[model samples]
Target: MKASWRARLAGPGYVILNGIRVINIITFLDIIAASVVMLVKISLTSGFFFFEAVTHAVTAGVSIFLLISELPWLCSYFDRDWPLLGHNSGFITLGIAMFMLGAGVLGNLNRKDMGQDHLGMTFWQIVLSAGVLALVMSTINFVSSFVFADGEKGVTARQIRIYGAVAGQKGEIPRTGSHRTFRLSMKREDTLPIYSPQAGRKSPTDRNSTRFPLKIEKISSPPPNDAASSRYSRDESGIAPPDLAHHPALKGEYI
Candidate 1:
């Protein structure tokens, strides 16, 4: 009886352990991250510095890890849905190239054109406009997540998993993580399915059927705001300012 009970217990133990491994240490860090972000959201809303000052060390670390894991996914989904916005590498490359070209070449070229040196209208007006456009495009890239994943993609979220069949013939079973097998006696002409990591994902909106994103986490961000400032900012009356002491120049600007 004890041996049988131990056998039963082993299965459950394996499942739990698998979940822990998949989430990795991110589970613990994700909690801290989500909490810090929630704090930022609430901090913006209440206009009261809960921790006196933003714990840059903690929050920054959280943001960095979360961004490392999730931002690529978000950005990829965005660029996939909207090609004009471009992906991370595309955006980064363009920015870097444009900076070098304008700063190095345009700067020198403008030196003699109208009798100026190492400076040009390419400053913020034109280049910054491109920068702003790039920013807007990147935002467009990020925004695509809201339309599909949030409150919609029911089937895709539940049924969609990266899956494969046994890769080889019935005579040989896979030699990798957690191999489960079942055999059934049948007619002499029965064929068994082979499974392997799919050549690609099968998700409908995946553009080309991608199975996994760079990362997956429950989506959470303060919703879109056209006002440019968060809810925690002050009003025209300048009554309750959000970190006014920190943002002195825009004391009334954001308000």
Candidate 2:
């Protein structure tokens, strides 16, 4: 039996959807873990204060996490590439901010003698405080990510142009096709070469040296010349070919 058009595409679509769901679930679990860790780190004496702190911490943590998860898209919309938002830095920042905000709120409550009803906070007040804390923390993270990204080794001008022209206004970045070329170029530029004194001293004239000889194996035929030329090329320096030097893996030369 032949399948309908929708049926034909359903299998791959289901797999993609499931992959997205799994990623979201993992992010949620990470947020929950961070909240639990913050709670454990606190040393609250009163049960009421502990509960209040926990509530504030968990709410702020979740809100910050959600904001950070959307930050990359936000930056992309503005034609910016923020590496920190795409990594654990966002999660770490959220966790630390939640801990600090929780402690500060608890301290303020104690100072006001909320326990004794001298200065009690309403439910709306608590919610407002949490919201403000989330906003402050998220803003700090956004600014830090923008200001401190590694310009020398991170995204390049070409990539910025490509991202802006292709995906900036759309509020979404494409990961495949031409974008991959730019991504690969950025990755290459980030690579750093390790220097060794001994290796530096050794030269082509050190044939009598005790270094083990490199054995060339003919396991398979070489890649087509056209493909090799398009992807990479050899340079006179004998390091990465000039054409491929921008690649992260090739930029770093081992001794």
Candidate 3:
């Protein structure tokens, strides 16, 4: 039985799915915590009939709904036809808006109440702080839903994973860290014989390709009648061209 459970848990995406679930649970817990604080403040002041207390009650209800949304085990009971009981996008969106509205109203009221108090030590402080934290967490969860969509099997979240067979067949696996493969490919390129241009000679691998070695033949002087030589020796020092007949660039053999 333990092995079977382990088998179910073992997968490339298991960790990611669990991480997302844990984050969502934590976010729901934050909302619950904040709502509890608000409810406590409401109880201490007046009944739910009061305007300020009604806002806290509404926020508390939304917080409970959000918490239930994260609990797959509890949600499975009424999730059949009930849209708001599970991790549906519409349900989450509605809960976020309702909770934020209630929290915002209570937060403003709490700020005003604090202005009339001598010592700032009150449940309002805790409620305000927790509400801020819950708001931040709720925003993160809502935004992240776009990236980690719900699974087809009605699971809360899932991640896309590429199987090894698919990668091997398609050759689309990203070579992220295979430095050795890159180095081996570079070595193969380096081992290829350098290209040469001597006519009638072939490269080590190809027959049509030519090969030649470069050499700069030093000429002592040029004939006076050679117009090209006049251009080469145009410098007033009268030095002959460094490469005259057997220049590598000309593809000529050494005489």
The top-ranked prediction according to lDDT is 3
Model 3 vs. true fold: TM:
0.41
Model 2: worst 10 consecutive residues (lDDT sum): 158-167
The local distance difference test score of each candidate is 0.33, 0.43, 0.48
Estimate, for each residue in 1-255, the C-alpha lDDT of model 2 and write its tens digit.
222432333334334433433443444444444344335444466677677666747655654555545444455433335443343222334435544554544454444334334333443244335434444554544443333322323422223322322212333333333467787788762353333453544444453444554334533554467755655454455565445456667655741
lDDT of 1 by residue, 1-255 (tens): 643443343344334433432342333243343333333333333454555235423443543443333232555554466433232111233233323322322232232321222223433243233333333433432332222111221211101111111111123222231132333333222343223354343333343333243333334554567565744576666677656478767677766
TM-score of 1: 0.18
- Which one is best on TM-score? 3
Q: Count of backbone clashes for each model?
A: 9, 3, 0
* Model 3 C-alpha lDDT versus the unseen true structure: 0.48
Ten residues in a row with the worst lDDT in model 1?
155-164
CA RMSD (A), model 2: 26.4
Per-residue error at 201 for model 1, in Å? 78
Candidate 3 local lDDT, 1-255, one digit each (tens)? 643433343353345545655665665555555555544544344353377666656666765665565555565454455544433322356337545644674455445443325224565555455556556655654554443432222222222222211212333222343566788787785456564454444444663233344343524453357666577576557776676546666674532
Please give each candidate's TM-score. 0.18, 0.24, 0.41
Range of the 10 consecutive residues with the lowest summed lDDT in candidate 3:
158-167
